[model samples]
Each structure stands twice: as structure tokens, then as C-alpha cells.
Target: MSRDIDYGNLMHSAMRGLIKTVLQDVADHGLPGAHHFFITFDTSHPDAELADWLADRYPGEMTVVMQHWFDNLVVGEDGFSVTLNFGDAPEPLYIPYDAIKTFVDPSVEFGLRFESAEDEDEEEPSADPMPPAINTDHAQEDADTAQKSDAQVVSLDSFRK
Candidate 1:
């Protein structure tokens, strides 16, 4: 039995599960009200599938907005596939859960950021273990005021050991 508790990996799993649930809901009953998603994923992931042009365009990562128009959203255990309009062309993409870098719903001031295992491995032992604060609010207001106001800033480091 391993005594080590992989809290970081655990958190990542939970966050991915949350995203899957939300996306499944959207797929079943359309995006409700003002809810929208800004999903940024690593395009280089082996399981991620996209057009050759898209891969050439976003060699590293890509962010897709799920608002006004989207089609064929199919959420699966490992990942999800969707068709999004790029300019006038509809492009289909498959993004694995592990490839996701960030998920944000600016409309409701909610967001999640995931650090890849490679990133974690590259961190120096002396570096701060705490992840940076995530500002859920995307309002175009003064940063100082926004920080001081009721804007929600979530930090999971508090839950870590």
C-alpha cells in the first residue's frame, strides 16, 4: 500500500469530473441562461483530435468559446467532442479531459485551472507549492477595486497539505 497521498492528482480528477458534468448537462439541455464556457486545452495531446489547419494554427494550445453557437456536443468518459464555427466554417474537435488547461465560466464568475504533471515535476523544491489565485471575475474594471470588491478568488492550496 502506498502511504503517499497524491492530492494534486486527486484535485485534478475532481475538477475534470465537474467539467464533464457541466458539459453533459449542456449537451442534454442546451446552455441555460447566461452560462457560457471558455475552455482552453493543449492541442498537442495525443488523444486530442482537430483539423490539420487548426493543429497548425494552435500548435501548443487553443481556447474555444461555447456560447452563441455550437453543435454535436458529445461528452464521453475520457473526453468530449463538439463542432464549433470558426469564421463561417464548422470545425469538429475532440478534447480529452487531461488535455484541458483551463475552464472558465465568466458569466457566473467561476473558473478552474489545471497544472500538467510535467509542469509539477519541473517546479523547484524551494518554489511555493500554493497555486496562484484564480480571479473568477472577468469584468473590465480596475484590478485593484476588483480585488477589493466582492469578486470571488478561489485558491485550492488551502485544502492541500
Candidate 2:
């Protein structure tokens, strides 16, 4: 039987939710201990909003470190807003979560990499779904045996190759 669920998309959405949750926690209680975020997002995405000069500076992507310097951090359901220092000037940046490619807290060695929704090659869902090659039996075993961690390394190299 063909699988109806899109596990990859489901996992991606859940991970993004995790990002929102963490940001919300920080907004409420401030950064806990040494935890800081390295949020990388597509500056050119339509939903992303930044200063004109900033967009010119980072035409493709930019990673902002939210350690000791960011202010007015707000996480919304679909996006976030933050004020960060830009050469002694404070610049407000609004980034849609869909535009965010990665979120990392290197202090805790935690990170998540997301596939850019703007990838030109992505095709719309077909009327008929394709069947997965892997068997479902091992999925439960894998889930049961896997351990949880604050960090995970996802290599884009695998996808590239």
C-alpha cells in the first residue's frame, strides 16, 4: 500500500515549532545560562523584511547571533522579529519562519537545518502520491532505539550528492 503521510514535511514543521518554542521562552525569561542562537535565514525571501541597506548587504542569506546583543525579540506563529546591532546602529529584522534555513544554539551544540521553501526545483504535490521504498516495520524499532539530544548535525552534502 502507498503511504499517505508526508513524514519529511511533518518532521520539518515540528522542528520549526521547536524553534518558535525556544524563541518564545527566551522572550519571556531571557536567554538561559550560555544559550544563544545562530539563526540563518534567506534575506531575499519575499516574506523577509529588513532595512534596504541590510538587504543590499546580505542579498542571499544572513546569520544573526542572538547572544548578548539582540533586543525586542518576538516570536509569532509564522515569523519572528528582532532588533540587532548593525555597526552600532539597531536594525529591526522580520523573518518568516519559512525563510529560515537553519537555527543553531552552538553553546549547547544544538542545531536544525531546514530545506528552503524557495528552492526553484521543488515541484507541487502530484495528484497521486508515490510509495516509499522502505518498509514500515523498522520505523517503530528505529524510533524506539533512537536517543534524544539537544543537537544534531545534518549535512547538506548528503542532499547535494
Candidate 3:
């Protein structure tokens, strides 16, 4: 009996399905009542497509709120695309499910955070399983040298004094 299943991956997939379901509902019936979404995703992810200006402004990760003025909201199995207004100009944004970091609906006080697969894949694994043994003597000497350096420590007690 192996209980060591990949629950995290399964949970991620389930959450993504929730996002797809919600987006599909929005496409079919529009955002119900006051429910709006705050979607945060990686702009640098290969699957994501943003306008040049948007990519320039948000080179890392960006969060977009979908509330008042947005159109052409299309929810696909793996991704979604929507035309949103920025400075009175409509710009299309394409976001893949894997790139998404967080999804929130503040009105309902609901939120979910996702681990980016791209980021995980990019992380370099350690060469050796066991870390190299630390040399305490060298480390202590280094600490002593740092203490003797020109670094200044300002204590909060000085302000009180």
C-alpha cells in the first residue's frame, strides 16, 4: 500500500481546473454579481503573451484585475485570453495556467496561490546529495573579520537615549 502519491501536483491540477471552470462561466454568463478576479502570473514565462508595453513595464511578474471593462474573454483548456483596456486602449493578454501565481476574488475573500512549474524546472539541482562539511574555524575567522570591518550598527536604544 503506497500512500506516497503526488498530491501537490494533483491539487495544482484541480485548482487549475477551478480556474478554467470559473473563466468558462465568465465567458458564458459574465462575472456574476460583484465577483471579480485578481490574476497574478509570470510575464517572462514563454507561454504568456503580452503587449510590448506591458512586457516592458512588467518584466517579471504582474497582477491584473478583471472587473469593469474587459472583453473577448476566451477560456481554453490550457490557457485564457482577454482584451482589457489600458489607458483607453484595448490590449490582449494571453496567460497560460502554468504561469499563473495567484487567483483572488477579494469580494468573497477567496484566494489561491500556485507554484510556477517554469520556475521549478529552472532551478538547478545540487551536484552532490550531501552538502560539503562546514569548516567552523574559517567561518569564525570570517565572522571576526566582518565584525572588525567599517560596518556600523545603529541600535534602537540610541534613539530612545
Sort by TM-score, best first: what order? 1, 2, 3
Candidate topping TM-score: 1
The candidates, ranked best first by lDDT, are 1, 2, 3
Instruction: Write the residue-wise lDDT of candidate 3 on 37-122 in tens digits.
Output: 66778899999999998899878877776776789999997899998776667889999997877776655656676654443465
Q: Which sections of candidate 3 miss by over 4 Å?
A: 1-3, 116-161
Model 3 residue 86 CA deviation in Å = 1.0
- Those runs of model 2 whose alpha carbons end farther than 4 Å from true positions after fitting are 1-3, 116-152, 155-161
TM-score of 3: 0.70
- Give me the overall lDDT of model 2: 0.68
* lDDT per residue (tens digit) for residues 1-161 in model 1: 66998897888899899999999999999999867676778889999999999899888887777776889999999999999877668889999999988776766777776766465576464253222222223342244223223323244444666
User: Relative to the true structure, how large is the alpha-carbon lDDT of every model?
Assistant: 0.74, 0.68, 0.68
Please state the error at residue 144 of candidate 2 in Å: 35
Greater TM-score among 1 and 3 belongs to 1
